[model samples]
Target: MTHRSSELSIAFALLAAAAAFTALPQPAQAQAPAASQPTAAAAAKTGLVDVTGARIHYQLYGDLASGKTPLLVLHGAFMSSDAMKPLIDPFAASRPVIAVDARGHGRSGGVDGKLSYDLMADDAAAVLAKLGVKQADVLGYSMGGSTAIALAVRHPGRVGKQVILSGTSRLDGWYPEVLAGIAHLTPEVFAGSPIETGYKSLSPAPDKFGQLVENIKALDATPFAYSDAQVRAIPGKTMVIIGDADGVTLDHAIGLFKLRGGGDVAAATQGFLTEAPKARLAILPATSHIGIMAEAPAIAAMVMAFLDDKAPPPPAF
Candidate 1:
């Protein structure tokens, strides 16, 4: 055949093959790999509850079937419910755990005015009431710890036991650097940081990031001071855990324990009893302020033992 004719034949053959391929029934698309099951920590049931005037976002791990006391967890400043992920699954393995994002943080709605510990504590109580939880053990870290103390004080009936990690009743318990950091929580301070990124990533009003920072700074500056008398009055069993090198001074933590009827009286009178004691003061060794929560394994073990009445009482000064 001539070159031109051969070319035409080849072209026609290619077209025919293309037509045949097109006519063939297409195989069904391979099912997209089933989405991986959520990790236990991420399997928490999340929801929003109207607590007082603000919408509170929360995560619940485990269920009532565990037959253990429910634990109400609160995170530190500039953090969300996500911050408690490390402790959720492990704690939930034995009991139901509830963690929340206070106003202006995470998926929770913000509020007007400064975010005082009293207001945050009230918010937590409101949330517990909304959840129909008559009483639950309360755990708080840093800012959350302050809120936990307020919760026990203001809504004493709602808190059966209180765990304050890296928390203090007095504002001055914090290191100067921490106070300075709180004072400097402007948008510029958090610029390009996870705090800023997290806020903008999920906030309903991302534009209000600057406002949130301002509110936090204001809250920090405003005194959330609880008197020694006030600390002495909290009715619930309490545990004050602080890192040896924490921003909360050791002396301050001792004062807190003493007010709770822990101090030297317990050590001298009670000695090292075989049973769980009412109040405790734990100064974790080789730890610092930021690592308090990150040391969840040790914290959880200590807390769980105390809650279960399996561990000895906290040592006295």
Candidate 2:
């Protein structure tokens, strides 16, 4: 199945699911504690760290002394650490969460050269070293997902558990149009325009549009490429999340399913028993490519539970 067809099938499935669950409200307590909330002494010790001439910005959440696995959340292309606000809130309440602004995005300074996944992975490793965190559960969304995979392959010891949200293992056979669209996005256009406009055209949401644009601009400035061999080389307890109705057709989903352990983006996520195998898959329902995390709290909750090493029931097909 091709990527485009797979996207379409997923979209149809999501629309059907949305019609059935339209009455649902936003999950209460979904947002993280406001900055005004009292900070634990441990949390207060947070500070930015400089890495490879770029001052990588990172904020540590929760009490590190608790010994819970620290989580490192990587944002997608053109997105800053702020993009992680939704997932970070709950995950930080129990274990320490570190959200980073990849170089040239958010607070991090840009460097001259083509952006590569290896370099981004190096940035992640630098952040881990700066925090004195020998190992951490790493989660990446979109572009960050590719980075996480690189980290798992390059610095296996630094990553405990790995999760890739809306991430793919290889760029091979990716929708050519998607790549062409991205390739044509120049840095000047990104700096002068509202980035969200382009994203909303692909997926609907206004809140994070500007930030998304900024991240996209950064990606343009630092173009990164990876090979399928590099992607498959990653070894860790890895989990992948994708929305069944992400506008891509079911053929795309089937192609993914044919990979070593891929399956429906929403229905295949039911086997994540904590005591059993450490890795699994999840295909969230009624979610598009962009809003998967926002529409499905269960997806985020599953991620949090996995990062925390707590057992949670897998997705019910």
Candidate 3:
């Protein structure tokens, strides 16, 4: 059950976890390849935006005037825009929300090379530019969260704020079991699983499933991580959200928060902050990594409040 500790992984585990957290057997609606043709009954606008060397599929909810700042959503590994639709809808009513399918996942296309967080982060910024959005509050779930961290690091000017859910900065931030689960994600292991099925059904190039698996396996089997200094260098507000039993360990989450200038509370100042925390952490009770997005309504409320600088004061523990 051992894997190369340096190897970066998590393609299968995310999709597997999605199934584990299934509330119902809802079918995913297919998205058109381009945004030119908006379906009559579509709540969200779907289309493809050309990035450096790939076409990234994206979905938009609400109009630009919905709010001053738009929320850009990044979906996890092995998932498409369909998976993030539910979690982002509630926020759409009040503000603009954009969900993107990362390279090689959902209906997006990928280059014939390795996948890295920096590359994906660049793609995200490019997609925003293509859509006429200069700044946005970035929110990434699972692997998407990791991408959000990278986005903030490389393109700080494009990101207004960050909300990382079920994501970690270092490879070691994940639990041992969680690492193991993602490390063993071979094509055979996911042959008939929902993850594979969904990919086959939604991918623009259905025949590229094996290639996608190999790319993900390579990504997971490699050492792709951001340093604490790199994370600390990101200049913006960040919120770290996770479940009590999430894939990321509490200690690691705290470490990330502290790097972002959080966890300085002490008795000297009565543990009260004269100013708000640049980095905030929220661990939901009785929640797990797989079901974190399902708690989107609550998560959205907190994020909206944080973005508006109206977050409630922390309770004494």
Each prediction's TM-score versus the true structure: 0.82, 0.68, 0.83
Clashes of 1: 0
Candidate 2 ranges with C-alpha deviation above 4 Å:
1-46, 186-233, 247-275, 308-317
lDDT agreement with native, every candidate = 0.73, 0.60, 0.76
lDDT of 2 at 8: 39
Candidate 1, 1-317: lDDT as tens digits: 87555543432332222212212332223112235212355488888887665788888887755667899999877777776665565677778889989898888887354588988998888778777788899889878989999998899888888888888898888765556555644476456666677777767678788888778778767766898888888887888999898878888888888888785465567556766667887897776676455466567767887677676546776
Model 3, runs deviating above 4 Å: 1-14, 19-42, 65-67, 266-268, 271-275, 313-317
TM-score of 3: 0.83
Using lDDT as the measure, the top candidate is 3
Candidate 2 lDDT by residue in tens digits, 104-197: 5555664333355677889889888987899999888766877887788789889887887776545532344455344434334433232333
Candidate 3, residue 167: how far the Cα is off, in Å = 0.6
Q: How does model 2 score by TM-score?
A: 0.68
| Alpha-carbon lDDT of model 2 | 0.60
Select the stronger candidate by lDDT from 1 and 2.
1
* Structure candidate 1, residue pairs in collision: none
